[model samples]
Target: MAEEEKSIFFPDDSHKLWSFGDTRTYQRLSSNSSGFLRQLFIVNIVFWAAFLIYFVLTASQPFAVQPLLLAVLLLPSIFLSLYVLVALRSAERKRLKLRASGFIIYAPLSQDVFNEHCIDFDQVRSLRLALHKRHFLPEEECLIIERRDGRSLVIPFEEVLTDIRRSDFMARLSAYRPGLLDLSEAPALPGEGGPSFTELWLHDFATQGTRESLGLLPAGGSLKEGSYTVDGIIGGGGQGNAYLAEGPNGTVVLKEYVLPVYRGTRLFEDLSARFFAEAKLLSALDHRAIVKLLDHFVEDSRGYLVLEFVEGPSLKELVEKEGAQPLSTVISVGKDLSAALLYLHGRFPAVVHRDLSPDNVILREDGSACIVDFNVARELERDSRTAVVGKQAYMPPEQFRGKPCPQSDLYALGATLYFLAVGQDPPPLTNLSPFEDAAEARSKDPGFAEFDEIVRGLTRLNLEKRIRSADLVYEKLSRLALKRRES
Candidate 1:
């Protein structure tokens, strides 16, 4: 006595049968009443009647020939009709069994039992609804079961007059597979049919609304088992949003991948992997001049990186508020940045900050500089699939073509320094040397003379002539700082 399993029936006759047991749930769908089947039957009748009329009008042979012709023409229709009947009957007989172990789809053919499909619970990734419509069929809903390894199975439902059946189905599904259909925290669903990357990117920025309205979790939302509470959204870009958060330890910054819509695409997968790797790399490095990664986690299909909260405005903000800084402060900040870059590049497999711009550098209250936002950093062993990503003004020519190296970072660093010195963005790189501009800057401010040589060496148009390593730049800046102190 299984305690007389509870049964819920759809009053609208949308679902053929549904039974729930303590250990399992069962569902059977009717296809005969489907809009698709009825339309198909009507179409077949129309075609058959038309053919009969045409044969009666055009027949020149005996009446016996007409029967043969009709039979020949109608064979395919008969076979199709039989297929539809059998399919509908089979669907009505099919039982979807849900157990703690997994899902089993079973039906009987003749005297033998047929298990059409069985899926292990571990392989199940998510379950969602898909709207499918065909020639004669009205728009119908199908339950789509998505697997972790990127496979899917679609189960069509019977035509129900109300949505109550769908609601019941979802409720039962959630009860059986609690988190499977909860895709809010799952990574983006993978598939190919969506808006283009460029279109999505444009839409993300062009649209204006609050963080929650734009699909971002609002401030005060708890994350990582209540370990971190979001303070507010600090910044965002094409890939993700950065939030200032507070935790038990102290204040931290959380960078979360916000593009849930791109989850199943190759681009989403690639970027997600890179984001995790970046978190790992940042966590391993120990430098005061570099933002420290505290932890990383995946929530609601979105990846997040927890970083140490730097308590200061970004260099870009500082400059915008208070024009150019003192030469000594500029030189000190440059030297600190160079040291951070040296540590990154000195690794066995050098890390290149592909998107080094003034905005990426933060100025502390004590006048020290720390490099933040390594979203586009990559190892020296570059992959062919790496896309060119960075600010146009800061990116070197080689970087624009997807070939970034230590020299490319150097060019950006020089450009950043130039902006700091002149209180404005540098002109686009052409045949004109940045040194010529630096020379004019030196005439206005003598401290620029000290950095003119360094800036020129670092921002050379030709890669062959540019300063080769961050270490070398650091060393040169260190000497200049020492010289300035001595004088």
Candidate 2:
């Protein structure tokens, strides 16, 4: 941890971002909360009501209450009230800067954020805190600050009260004015020229979004033999868990779609068909780097797809556990990846793995890359095409306008390589969330000029301007690998 700090930096953390809590056991209230939000509820109601009445009575236009104006005022007030009442309820994330030790990082979300980028957290006076009055309330409170920035980060103190370890965190923070030493292991590297790693983490300390209250996991009961036995859970996304399961005589991976009833049946069926269709399409093709589809089934009124289960860690896991891998791992993985794409694209009706991120690719025990989660939207009926099946960030711009093709897959591939080269996820295309992860990653480690150049060629926002094909990516990567080997 200390070694990584030397090579990293963090932006000022004066401003705070979102917060959450775990219900320890999935109850309506997350366990990390302190119920401070409930207290804030009474306080906010009384304060807002008092001021709102006074303002309405004296205002020239009265309580204009337009959605737009009301929205603007309520937004900050909500954040403020949450900070005021729910002390340490929410965890504050620096949108721009981070504070170092002894000193507070002063990166502001709205103004002069760049100034706080390089400042050391050690030099700052205090850090921010997310406070809440209750476990269920969405509002938060702001308590700690090097000085006074008018905002606090989120921290679930109420629910944490019951957790001995979490309660210890509170006790530790109490000793230091700003709070306990920040505890994030992620490099403080804030993308751009921000505070050094040590400085940024100086104020890093937070609680889990939810507090686990004694009992959360289901009783460890063995079930009678069933059709399938779940193996290792590989990963999860908007879809569901990707588990290695065994059925009949062979091993396979199954992806189940768990969703809220509100998503509508149309969306679920559409996703299921698309998944099956993609598997079927992939099944028809044989590629060294691609996982094969053995069979698919639907029973018990549930949706699930089965495919070959390749063993080994994912590219993302490798990076997190062991920084950047040798170019050999990169090239070997890249070669298999490109070969599979080449085969898929050459098909009479080309296939596209629209969401090609590290999480979707696995490093097999045989030293090859196996692609997963290729979307088969084309296989679906026209009615289901608009349901949105791919991971937005890895998708090309064309996808945003409702287009999926081979080129779209290449966009994902390019993004995948960029992530490999930089050790970070790319920016997302979906609007449901924000903050481009790819851009932030690149800023963190530009690497060599050639490497940076490669990332640029692959991840261009403009499809036309981006590297044209799988073959081209392979060719460039081959040359890059050869050059690195010689050097």
Candidate 3:
């Protein structure tokens, strides 16, 4: 027999019926209760008594009440009260479903009140709890959800209370988006009702105590309607910025591409289209040595790419801390990078990583290298527009002229290796000769000469003299590493 799905139901007497299941859970709110029925009965009696008194005072005949007249007057009042009770009960029959990605508020009778009933975690801007009380009735509490598009959803809090002793309904809501609900209270006059604590929390959370900001997004701010929360910037360049963020999939690097062109212009549209197309292509790639592209989007007239976060330090940081790397370490990194490039270049029509540098290579904790930063990458095509992109020191002559080919990446790789083998950057736009600068490597490894030859060939000024492909580069590095191991 198939095992029954495990679920926990709230206590029988609770106004809310909460059921927790494996894949789906829901909180059902109903207004029908014995207490409400008793209240209604009492109200009907009082209403009829008031009507009888009014009729007697206004009657022309003294000490006499007509049964037919009384029946006609009280009938409408009874029907009106029943209609009101039905409407109120219908309005309270709401269901809150907790989905994997977000939550849904289902109010079949009160659907017209909200712009949207389903809300993703990213769509939420801020949440607030407010209490409203009138002259003689019990206080009513509501949860107000403010969205990014200036719309709001007000959910009654009374029926949402579950019988769970450990956690309440609001606590469950908070679990959906950690740190989302601001526990702080918003200052307000005793009777004011329009504004709540959400506005104050949002204002402080976005500003971070600074009136003026220098970056495109604040540290605690979110993007894509709150899907990704920015922790802080990881890196930035002339064209874009990269941020380390917390997302549904855990830590991710958010790369923002800033297009200076005005929105709605031909240039802007063209740029945006190309960016998305390239992003789509990149997202299809799966390689252990390459940082995976998780997602991409455009918001506020800027393009953003979500990439898997590499756990280890960049090659640049490694070198900065340890000075020049050992010959074996350099060879391992070279082979890994070459393999990654081969995978990219082997794609149909070819994908050229126009930017490759020590700063773009991250060494994993397991010592394998992962190539990152595809902001300037493109599919190989001779007729494509030339955009001067990449660091000057690592960029070759062709790349500086905005005409990078697959070999342009080889040159940058050579420069990166040169920085690792020797403790400094090679001169830009010049052929590299490692004899004078690689004494430290030579002292450490006897096979440094062969490695230097590979670097020299890769950084050659003439295209004909440069190393041909990532395959060839990988072969050469493998041989050098093998020889070192044998020796």
Among these predicted structures, which one has the highest TM-score? 1
lDDT pick, better of 2 and 3: 3
Per-residue lDDT over 1-487 for candidate 2, one digit per residue giving the tens place of the 0 to 100 score: 0111111112111222321221011111113333344655766687679768987888898857567766677767777776664343223333221111222222222121211223233333445454434455575443333423333333333322322233233332432234334434212324445433212221221212222222211222111236667666655666555666777767777765542232213353355434435645665768768777665543223335677778888888888888655545666677778878888777765665666778778898888889865664343222123334566668777776655667777767766765665566666642211113335533543234455565567667776777778898788778877776676
Which lDDT values do the candidates have, in the order given?
0.66, 0.51, 0.69
Residue-by-residue lDDT tens digits, candidate 1, 167-273: 33343344334446643432334563554322232233223122333466687889879999988988887877889999889999998775344323335435644
TM-score of each: 0.55, 0.45, 0.53
TM-score of 3: 0.53
Compared with the true structure, model 2 gives a TM-score of 0.45
Candidates 1 and 2, the one with greater lDDT: 1
